[model samples]
Target: MNTPNQEAPAQNGKRRTRLIALGVAVLVGVGLYGSYWYLHARHFEETDDAYVASDLVQITSEVAGAVTAVFVDDTQHVERGQLLVQLDDADAQVSTAAAEAELARTVRQVRAVFSQADGLKAQINERQIALRSARADLQRRQKVAADGAVSAEELQHAKDQVAQLEAALNISQESLRTTQAQIADTRIETHPQVLAAAAKVREAGLALRRTRIVAPVSGTVARRGVQIGARIAPGAALMAVVPLDRVWVDANFKEVQLAGIRIGQPVELHSDLYGKDVNYHGKIAGLGAGSGAAFALLPAQNASGNWIKIVQRVPVRIALDPKELSDHPLRVGLSMTATVDLHDGSGPLVATQLRSEPQRVTINEQRDAEVQQQIARIIADNAGHAAL
Candidate 1:
């Protein structure tokens, strides 16, 4: 109904609207992708290859023996100092009895040595008196011979008696010196021989105690390799104690992802086992010194004729809450996904940069008083019986 030029204006107006819509769509698309890139810049920090790990102490026999009893089976929960196994203790008992007998013999020998000192003193006094009597007799015989009452032979015999007495006195004096020297040389308190023998007794006692294998840590046992009548030796792997409370996650992060990573930063994790139903709370405890492959048995030989560049990942240790770990027990090597918010980059990249060594194990301050009391009771019991 309108002219051609008027219709052209209408078409131009419609074209402008379409171009505006297209421009708006392009801007929104660009903005969305940019936001995505910014949010996931540290995606490498959240690794799917991360795993839960903890210190696994392998229990082994310190003494060689045939296992007589296995108190714990695989997956058994044990407390520290709880007996785990018992070896054939007949041999250990025999050794302990022999050591006790040897200790008693040593005590008797020391007492005898002390008594011999007194006996030697008495013998020395007797010899001194006998020598004086012999000298007096010789003088009397000489005077009597001059007066012609005694024969010259009798005087000579008296002189000979005095000479023999002198020899006997010298021998007695030498024996006294030797006995006194021995008394001075022998020490009742920790003499070398006594120490050597005491060490043997201690060794025997330790061996006897080892016959009853005890758990070194409080945890659940796994991978048990012991059975009744099984012979074991030192350093042999018997069982493993997995302390769930001490479990931590080791996340390998790319080098680029660590630019904003800081110690004490909070972490949120979800394990595959839990399927996002459970959330774990943790903090960045530390960073590994080097890549994992660097610690492998057969490391890559980069110095060879052929070499290729590979992206290495560094391990970051994250300490989880004990409550969380206990609530949801995680086995070693369980896969997990972790996210660390790096919004606060003011914190130190390290934990205190401390030169001081961290204590691997610590005594609970709350239980110190109780532990001391128990230790005191043990000492009193031992000292009260045979303090001497």
Candidate 2:
């Protein structure tokens, strides 16, 4: 058996050994964490306060009408130019018909004016020939009367006829001038009256086409508020189209963490919905002009007596690769975690220029082409052929 004093010393030695081992473990842990911060963590900024965002294209009516049909519902995928809704088009159709008839009538009236001018020109030519004939006869009669072979009465009658022909020629020339003035320097298509009528026709056609609401972009429908038989007015919100392919991330970072952030930095993102299995790659597109608090509806009044300092966040826009987005789609307002690489500090903190072109441009395909065809048909039917 060992002595009591020897046992006490042995236990104290064991305690000292344990203390040494714990100290070494702590030192190693700290060193590893420090190395990690220096090599990687320092060159990046991360935030979980990010979300997918896209242009929420609102669908609104350009003309007021009662809803006749709802072609799409919530979450339906629609292509660009596909019809989404239809309004009662009876009034629009009647208006378009009236405009079309007016255009046709105007074309005929312009053609008639051209015809009248040509007729006046013909009358002028005929009057000139008559005057020439009358002058020749008068000269012959005067020559004969001087020789006593022609009677004075016959000679006087010839002179009177020549005078009458000259007066008639002058009247015809004046009439031709008046008619030419009405149709001067313009074709049937370019006439002011015809143009005015054509404008009416275009306006009416646009209204008629507006009755059929089409998708402005290829997107999934959301927030559909219209119903059948609902009377909607111009600018009323019917629904929204969210183009998933055009989505970007809006990451909000604290003010203290924004010093190294810059445009064009590479970003890696993870959506909570997809978890860490799927990673998204993007680049910083821009930085917000101000912090979120500054743009809030009820901004904090820091000047008041009850002021409390709070960390503010600024939004950073990150544009994703279109191909990646196509393969892995994202919806607006989805939560995401973003990590931006700040190794390259050679970019601007804010964009100094605007985009050279618009991101998107939507045109009403049906209204423009259909209206043109209708106008051409009206002109062809009324004026015998379409204007070149």
Candidate 3:
């Protein structure tokens, strides 16, 4: 059997060895964590609370009609100005035709008014000559009646003829003035009546063109709710077109983590769809004005009893590179992880202003040009040789 002293010394040494090993392990763990925090974590702010976003361009009918045909379906790619839907344009066409005919008829009618005014002018000239001749005849008859060379009845007839011719001249002059007033200071094309009819034609043309719904922008179709023979009204949400090329990411980070975050800071994003293999490079576009909870439908009442402090998240918009987006498309609402590099701390926390130019612009060149062409053609067809 071993002695008590030997047994006590051996047990003490074993206990000392176990304590030293535990201390070394603790030191190693702490050192590794410290290195990680210093080398990789501090220079960036990361969050998994992020998603892809885009402007959902809702396509609706400007005019109401039954859907005659649907050219696009859900998930189909469309180009700007491409026809996506066609309404039953029977009524629009008839209205357009009527407007055109009205415009033509009005132009001719205005021309006829001008002609009538000219005819009235000629009649007035003829009446003036006749009045002069009647007056001369009355003077001659009066002189000869005093010399007993003309009868009293004949002289009276000559005097009456002069008065009648004078009255007729006055009536003709009034008629000419009235007729000239209608055609004065205006051409056939610029006449008020023709202009009014032309406006109606433009309105009808716009209505007819609106019956064919075209894509406002190049994008992918979604939420298509229209079908053949379906009656739709103006402002109805028939579908939406999402521009994948112009998508951005909205990253929500905690309030505490918002420090040092600024506009123009470089950001790296990884979508859950592509994992970490595909990286998206972007820059901070701007930060949200307020936290989500602040704008929520039902906000928290912090002043009430049993109030618990919660971290609020503010959204940060990040614009992606267009070329990258074209190569690797990201759909709206896709989950993403964003890590913003805090190395460049020179940017502003809040954008004070935006660019002078608008981010999105709409042009009506084609439709406007078509309507202008139609108006010109109608005016030309009915304007005749009349000066416009």
lDDT of 1 by residue, 131-194 (tens): 8998988887777787899988888888888888888878878877876675566554344444
Best first by lDDT, ranked: 3, 2, 1
Task: Between candidates 1 and 2, name the one with more favorable lDDT.
Answer: 2
lDDT for residue 67 in candidate 2, whole number 0-100 = 96
Q: Where's the lowest-lDDT run of ten residues in candidate 3? A: 356-365
| Model 2: lowest-lDDT 10 consecutive positions | 379-388
Error of 1 at 192 (Å): 2.9
Using TM-score as the measure, the top candidate is 2
TM-score of 1: 0.71
Query: Cα-based RMSD of the predictions, in order?
Result: 6.7, 2.3, 4.1
For every model shown, the clashing-pair count is 0, 0, 0
Angstrom error at residue 280, model 1: 2.9
For each candidate in turn, the TM-score is: 0.71, 0.93, 0.82
